[model samples]
Target chain A: MKENKCCCSKKQKKLKVVNIGLQTFAESLRAQGVTVAQVNWRPPRKLDSEMKNILDDLL
Target chain B: MPVKKVTVQQNRYADSVTLMGILDAVKKSGKVMLAEVQMGTPQNVEVMRKLGFDIPATVNANDLVIALEAQTNELLDEAYKDVIDRLDRKHTDGEETFNSIDEVDPADGWNLCQISLPGEYAAEEAKKAINKGLDVFIFSDNVSIDEELQLKRLGDEKDVLVMGPDCGVGMLDGVALATMSLVREGPVGIVGASGSGAQEVACIVEKAGSGISALIGTGGRDLYPQIGGLSMIKGIKRLCEDDQTKVIVLVSKLADRAVMDKVLTFADGVKKPVVAIFLGADESLFASHKVHGTFSLEGAALKALELCGISCKDFEISDEKIKGIVDSYMKKFSPQQKYLRGVYCGGTFAEESLIYLKEHNPDSQLYFNMATKYARKLDSHLKSQCHTLVDLGSEEFTIDAPHPVFDPELRLKRFRQEAQDPETAVILLDFITAPGVHEDPISPFAKACAEAIKARGGALAVIASICGSVNDPQDIVKCGKELVDAGVILTGSNHQSTLLASAFMKALDNRK
Candidate 1:
């Protein structure tokens, strides 16, 4: 048999995940026993067009 | 007059799922007649004002607004506390949460980032993750085409994978992600643009005793002329390179003509056997290529299984069996019952059902809300025409609320409305079970179906199909049993269910 060389296939090592956005997604991964880092992500504050453009350039 | 209370938490942000959870907890308290928890976006603030709440003008999208209406001040305070407690409990669940992707430790060997944020913020976060050399699976929808192209191009340049902006289902290394079935790992790999379409194929593959190597999602618009099937090409190449994948399956609705030719030509060069199902496209397009083109999702799964040296015999229903079922249903249908109303939680299932209805019953007037050449567009999605098949998970129905898969209230109401119509003969439904969806999605509908049948004295037929594996959090066998007990006809697959509904409609027409 050929060796498993898929992008996800790394010699039988488990995948570590960084889950952003929905909390249930992290919970789902936890239930499956996969190691996960949950990120408490929220939308950035709404900015007007001019202020946003200025910040975009400055950043 | 009812007492109304409003609170705006400054500079606070919560995902839609969290806010919906808080709202559910508040409503369950039974102390308030009206309760709403939403971000203070301009549209939401306007809605709050229309509902007779005095929302301050300073409230912005970053604020968390909770509004409640109770009979007394005491009850109002209690309901408000329940919302706060639920929100606090969510925050304090002891998961060691991070603030952003930048905070994620690179030394932890994290291989992937799964994003489900709002579209406006998703692209930026995805870019950050891609820059970190982590493969991204974006579950958010509404991302602009230019953003998707830019992200895919960046992914190519970085030598990483970008799955979707609206991609909902994926399985990598036997691990299911966001709304996918828990199928065992094996030789067949899938690359799909339709969430529910891929899900149906995965569930069917598992049910037939075969398994999946991976199920890669390429968002919905990956095959458009502008996007040009970027993720799909990447997904196909990855699967082809994977030694575990022996057969590859491609599932999507019809794509742009030039893009379809390009994708098919690319597939023809791959060393592995490929099965393609472009739902509305003719099979002749695959004649010149080495790809095996199928017409239905069930056919796609069975064909993939056949390529892997496995045969599945139980997926299709015989014509004799169909005739018997149709005869039984015709006896119960009243003279006034003449149309089929398909209410579906899975968009792809609805699309497949519409295609099947068109192919089988071509003369029947078909209507849908989604874009399809087989059916005419409905004037308003809220209203269904004759022989209407509506994808309740479409954006129009989900703009203000969660998808029907997560919240069944909208679909339940639509089911009841169709049941009440005297001209409705058969109601076709598709129930999808996943990790994050409602725990017992079918029980509420099963109870409603029982009542509808009793009120009509068993004159209506409700046929349905379940899309999930036994490994899913929801018990598939139990769901099937509940549907059967409620006098609903359950089939082996969505194609079988739609075929049964088409048979019932034709038999009714013959009697007329």
Candidate 2:
């Protein structure tokens, strides 16, 4: 899986990565002050755990 | 003894007869007089009868010959009204028929309006309707850019929707409507610079048994540096936010790599593969990402389906046939005739032709700029000689008329001139016709092309490409064959035409 930040518009500032769990990408993006969501079928566990950890750190 | 060709005015309307039946009647009867078939509903038949034309049980050759000389406008109007009226009464999928815009709620989904209104009326009327909060669906070709920009700006400010100035196929809210609605919905969403390219992708996805979530058309405007893909960028972002969309597809004839990279950077984070197919560009720029770049429009569709793991029924031309056509054309062509001039209806086709020319002759100069200001960037020598690629979609070309697709006359005039130029050896063109195309385009177009070839003494070779249905293939085949008989070569797909043109040029050099 490759990781990159959202660069489409000036207003958007989120880090997004694919082939990883939606939770992880969303969490990273959200931390960067960007809204995040996933529109796919599967979400992996390890990536989901990383997202949960990031959320905890933010809290 | 000698015979003179006499013109007879005939009008025949046959309500029911197989094509073969009509052909047999015409053949037995001799040169056509005028044939008019009223494929209308029973109520419409009543309406047509009220309009005062004789509604015959079957058309005769005498009537067809007369129709050839008689005014076609009145006959065509009657024909259109007949179809609309029939559509009003017919029920599909056991659903009740709904007539007029008042019957359907505009807020529920896209309030589609396909404007084939002539001249300035289409743009003017579409603007009027769009101002009234209507979701405008445009199918007309040759609409002015200024008019389109005004409509687009209005759509942006008023929260009203405007799909295209020349846009074709699209799916809205899971409902397939508009031109080239041949795809089933899948997790993929697409934004295309060309209408046919968009429709082709959707069809490919459907063949894989997958459907499209959203297929946005940026028309030919979005990728031009001035347009900078503004609406497309908006649509992409919106689809990315949608919960149903998984993969995204971006296809265009051309894109500024710098602008594309911005979208690419965003797509890289989406957790899904983004298939980018910019037809005329070299794909080496996107070599790093999961992005799969494709040369041909159909090839992009195939790759997108494959990456999605969708099972696609093979639809595009086979690789062997593509190579064979190229090789054969090359062997027969002379290299000394190297320069190419394209008078195209589709912007993408012209772009593809230039790419082919540039690839073959790296030193070749191209005079193309999406912006009027940058228009000076074009090779002045080529531009002056009309050897430059003239997209009928541009404002300069459409000022007097819309486009060669809808109004082939002006382009044909320019094409004839270019064909005779000693500097020009090849001319590429797009002859598009589909179900919703302008009535009776082929015969007039074929006749013009024949005259041009005859004038040039076949000094210029042409490659005509078409976008139409396979079920009714004869229209293009007939046009292609006619041009071929007149000493001009023709092919069906843009890729095939480009490959053949390139191979021919390359082979000519080898002979040297």
Candidate 3:
């Protein structure tokens, strides 16, 4: 749906992972010498359909 | 008297993984005897209530609940503040953190996203990652089927891989992801719907002197008709086109009849040698197709090894050797001990053992927590019935806390329970060692086994297999040694361990 801005041309490089929701997966990858960005993901607050639509339009 | 307190944070929610970490930290402070940090889901509220916490009736699923017990109200308050502090702590030990996928800037060469959030939120995050051209490996479970279909469809249209809504084990470009062991890079690639099934095969392949090019997990439901084996087909095609992968192995429990046909037909077209293990499927299903079909994990591993031009005769124990081992164990059993109980942390291992035991002893009644055609469902997972195989990784066991692979307390308790049963002649177990699991999962269970054997006057037999490699962080060789030193019979593979347990059961039946 969006342009692939994250695509890397180098295929032989070490894998880069963005681990969301569970720091352990990121830690495990980092322990193995892989490059990882840990995301401290928490559940989003509840929004009704009308509020969600407004937010979606605003964003 | 210990004081118990329940505090609910309205509209504040964290993933179970994060809550588990907070729970551990609070308990380790030694200020609280009983502490639980969980979302206020019905099941979690029920668990807290059972633990003697008085949760408010107004608490809802979106709310965060922290229950604590301590010697005094002061101690309880201190521990409660510690949990809140940990929750408010933003940075995780100097590692860079992002609030959402939008902040992750894909140009940093981030090619993949591994999501382990709660099921309700997993799909939206996965959609964001996929839209950003990042391949996804989801470890979260409980996502609705409609959400899974929508995500897979989006992934298909985007051409980026979607690994799972409940996917656990995976390895890409020589890096183990999620709960997978660190397997060496080599010729074999796997497309599996079952996490533990693929892990077993990968470990067995490594033990057979072969290695893996990739291990792609398609979650547990990808092969159902609703999903149409979307991820599995994509994975098979990707492995087929990859230069490093010379052989492809497909592993899963039996899918819908039409879906199985569709997948095998697709695999049949691939030029590379393919091995399929549709557990409980008749062997004849593969006779018509060019792809090889196997019924057991070991059989699938050996077949893939053979296709790779590797001789794995040493990996297989002769029937005579199995008989000798069985005879030795049978002599130690008392006249009253007759049944076998398998307490497994890996679900696939339990299913494999249940299938094997049922095949050999068709007349014997078998029970499992997960219902199968051959085995009836256990009345209660907390208590093992005769000839029971329990998958402690199932949702029933994992709803309150982390998986048994990460915390062995549940399996250990079940092991002790089964060990004390007078009718349990053989107790079967499977231990998985990987990046994210417990450091030494075998020793505590081994110690418990030793005590149980001593208590039984050496009349009990404990048989187990470890699914890991020498490259894992845990000392696997030492783990095996711990089991042996504790009078536990250790096997090289889960299949062999199950076979030995089955043989012991058959022998006990004959003696009766």
Candidate 4:
């Protein structure tokens, strides 16, 4: 529900990140009442660029 | 108790002219403390012996240098290790009474297993994990494909998951109990060919207002030609099939193009858009629902978000965006330039530069080395290029050393020679910075680059990519500011540097 101005322009918008990280990060998300899902998989085979994007989406 | 002179310039002695007179004065001085003298440089050490001073038998110049560096590194390792060791001990010590199935029973706590056991023993390790009903993380890389296939199957049968055979880094939930950051609850699934690659990707995602579903380190083996992404395919498929995953991004330092093609083919069928970034791949061949061609490791992360429709508020200042903007800007700067001379620290970035140039002007000769042992070893299409992807790691260029990251002086000198040549119009450089990186990377890199640009009289636009960690105290932004201030427009990552340098060539062609 928090709002901030967009960097692209000056329009204000809600800040959001669904759930991020494991325990503490998850707890923070839950405190904000964000729904969380546990994903079971090995880390990405490519660890540099694309991996971060996937992580960003999850957040 | 005497401190050794390690500086480049030798300490000044009074102009008494005689070495003995200086030694006599040294001995006469009430402040002279005779503990041990550490002779620093090979040149200085030789001069010291000629002066007839009885240098210690134990303190040779090489030994002193080695000891100093090793001691410093050892101390740092110990400090970080102390943190990890204490945390791991606490997690282990508390496990006797902790509750919950998702959580490791405090009694059965801290199953930190080394994965280098022989095949039979490895199977036994998997069996033990199942018997204890523990979550397994594997960190060894020498295990064969067959061994991995067996171990993975066993974990599945036991209804528990195994992390890696060569896996070193992952964050399970939010407990960075094992790795530095342990685990946080986020939606990103990270896969990498290199261990450091995984670590870097995770750090960036964390910095950019996101977290990870899981950060998987597949050891370098999964991307090698023999395995061809089979395990990686499994890992990716699992993430993509998961209802929790909104996006899957793949990162790797190096991979076979054919294997990458197969992975992409599979990716094309996924409901979630995949961001496939293959390092050193020609941009012309990038084919995916959402493909990002990047040379440096960080570019893949930025492009993945862009492809996923999650625009960063500051993507403009992000490394990739900056490189794109600067490349376009440079394209406008010089419209008549033809040939380019690129000096890059990273091997993969160098190849991408050549690829970008060819795309712009196929007729203009592009020179670099992609050093594959034989012609038949390479795909026919890749064989046509003369640009050598000179692995700075190889002993040929990395003479008298184990690491290329430590020594950039050799390449900087060669870059200067290339700049003086009349045919060279532009210089592209891939400069990287990170912890335990080259000494004075920004200044030395900028100095060499400025010299080249000045020699060409502003015709040469030096484009650079800073590949250091975002969390690094001295990250790419600071490095870029320094480079930009020095008259060289620093691109964010290697991919952008290549693209911008190539775009400049394209702009030149349009003028002609």
Model 3: docking quality category: acceptable
Per model, kept true contacts as a fraction are: 0.57, 0.00, 0.55, 0.00
Clashes of each: 0, 24, 0, 49
Which residue pairs of candidate 1 clash? none
Interface RMSD in angstroms for candidate 1? 3.6
Question: Model 4's DockQ?
Answer: 0.02
Query: Whose lDDT is higher: candidate 3's or candidate 4's?
Result: 3
Candidate 1 chain B lowest-lDDT run of ten: B88-97
**What TM-score would each prediction reach against the true structure?**
0.88, 0.53, 0.86, 0.53
Q: Write the per-residue lDDT of candidate 4 for residues B347-432, one digit (tens) a residue.
A: 54554555455655676545454434211111332122222223344345565543455567676665666566555555666664
- What DockQ do the predictions score, one after another? 0.45, 0.01, 0.39, 0.02
Candidate 2 scores a chain A TM-score of 0.31
lDDT of 2 by residue, B380-492 (tens): 32253323566765666676685666566777777766766666666777766543344344566567667766665555567776654332223555655666776666664
**Model 4 misplaced regions, further than 4 Å:** A1-59, B1-108, B111-187, B194-214, B221-225, B237-245, B252-273, B279-303, B306-309, B312-338, B372-391, B419-423, B436-440, B451-459, B507-512
- Lowest-sum lDDT 10-residue window in model 4 chain B: B8-17
Query: Which residue runs does candidate 1 get wrong by more than 4 Å?
Result: A1-13, A42-59, B1-11, B22-38, B44-56, B64-96, B369-371, B378-384, B399-402
TM-score of chain B of 3: 0.87
Best by DockQ: 1
Interface RMSD of 4: 21.6
